[model samples]
Target: MPEQPAGSRPTLEAVAARAGVSRATASRVVNGGAGVRQPLADKVREAVEELGYVPNQAARSLVTRQSGAVAVIIAEPEFRVFSDPFFEQQVRGISRELTANDSQLVLLWVEGPGDHDRIARYLGGGHVDGALAFSLHHDDGLPALIRDSRVPAVFGGRPGSGSGSGAAVPYVDCDNRGGARSAVRHLAGLGRERIAHIAGPRDQTSAADRADGYRDVLFDADPALTVQGGFTVDSGARAMAELLDRRPDLDAVFAANDLMAAGALRVLRERGRRVPEDVALVGFDDVAGVAEAADPPLTTVRQDIEGMGRLMVRLLMRVLSGRDGREAGAPASVIMPTELVRRASA
Candidate 1:
């Protein structure tokens, strides 16, 4: 083989010459050898190794019309994303799945409304092959922006079109309503009357579903028995306080997520409320470290947060793989199951 110049990047032509093959054939081999014969691929690889040649990723993506990267967008503030174990679990699953598939993960945080335009431009620019978005509020315009960009995307929770039309968007979410129902039923079985619900933000579907589930159990549900929370521990504590003020006789409480439940636990502890004995308590999400660490170990609804993340990436990948780079005709949205993990709190 001819000696390469000092400080010069090895070129494809040199590898092709060393391999005794056409440059196009060598290119195919270096770019994953999809149709090249095994012996020919081996030869190209050997030549590449001999020459210390590295295929330029930008040029490769241009040829394939694919970035070979996937974006994981979380529509939340940095504090919440960093503090919440739920987001951490989801991202871990996404990273694992994307890594196993030899794809890059580009994490994006939508901190403010301005980020939407920037994210839309990024998606439209073909910077990533696909996107996995999560935590959309009903009023959030992300779904519309994504649809306009024409990039295949899968959401972690059921997302509205940011318009009231409720246009279709493929997603993977757990059975939130059913899980809430189960939690309420358990509390009722404990013979706790005046059950109260601490719901999350009403604009998000998951929160809305959980709230609806609470109402399904208690038809003609007392308006005062339900208080809204922001899915944060502080919000949970505040909402719990409001519930106590409204109905001190309330015998049980159900919070939308474990974070809020943990908050409620603190408030209950402060107010001299005993867990399960004086007032039974339950929470959702069963987030690691939050539920089990609560005084008296929380009994909560468990959704596979990481599993849902993996499934979201899997679904978007399927759509990205569609023929002619178009979506594969909208594969049906998926809803994963949830469980009511029994523990000491209940």
Candidate 2:
């Protein structure tokens, strides 16, 4: 055979000719070596290396009816995406899992309702095989659009509607309610009464669930003890101030997430309330930097954020591969367990 010109891109035809096989056989081997014999697959691989060939993903996707990519949709403002360590850990897990499966991740940040149409169109355009969505609020219409687009999806938390009107979507979430229950229980065990809770945003299921857990423990507790927060440091600090003003004798607190806990800690210090001495404190998520960095080191409910991310991908991949056995209904959901991590704060 004549030597191919240098610097020219190698094609499937060239690789097939070099391997002494049909183009169809070479294509199968290049895609995944599924049905082709071992010896022939080896020859095709060798030929591919020799010619420095690279498969055209766009062309290959069309033939296989698969994009070999997954979308990671974060339905939050840009600030939250950058500031929240929870999202960072989850994305890391997702990236690791996708890399292991030889799939690509397409990250899409939905800033608001205005971006819904664009995101829906992109999902409907057959850009990815499935999606992993996080930080979904109740009023967000992205879920409905995702449903309409008919793309397989797995949520990072329990799926619900802001207006209470949508069907449930498959999701992988840590046990927010259970984790909160454990945190509150620990405070109770420490004999800290008048316990207050700094809850997360009411629009998200995670915050709602954690609040519910607190209510379960403090059934007859004063309603004024619970203050709403936006899961930010400033919100937590403000909420803590409000709690202190409302219930001066409150001896313990549970902040929905670590960031809020850190905020509350600062306020406690400013107010001259000693952590775990004058007042006990507990936080959730056990975020690496925030929880451990607190002056008194927060005792927190540890959720496997990365594990939840990995589990979301696994579930979505199952649905995409048609192995989930759902009989053409809603996708499956997984709830991971949470554990209480002891520290100096509580």
Best by TM-score: 1
Query: Which lDDT tens digits does candidate 2 get at residues 1-346?
Result: 3466876778999999999999999999998859999999999999999988889777876776588889999988889899989899999999999999999998889778888888988898777988889888887776677777777788888867543334456889889999999999999999988899999999899999999999999898899999999998889999999999999999999999999999999999999999999999999999878998888999999999998889888888777766345456566688899999999999
List model 1 lDDT by residue over 46-160, tens digit each: 9999889989876877777688899888889888899999999999999999998899999998888878888888899878888888988877787777767777788889985
| Alpha-carbon TM-score of each model against the true structure | 0.84, 0.82
Alpha-carbon deviation at 303 in model 2, angstroms:
0.8
Cα-based lDDT for every prediction: 0.88, 0.89
TM-score of 1: 0.84
lDDT of 1: 0.88
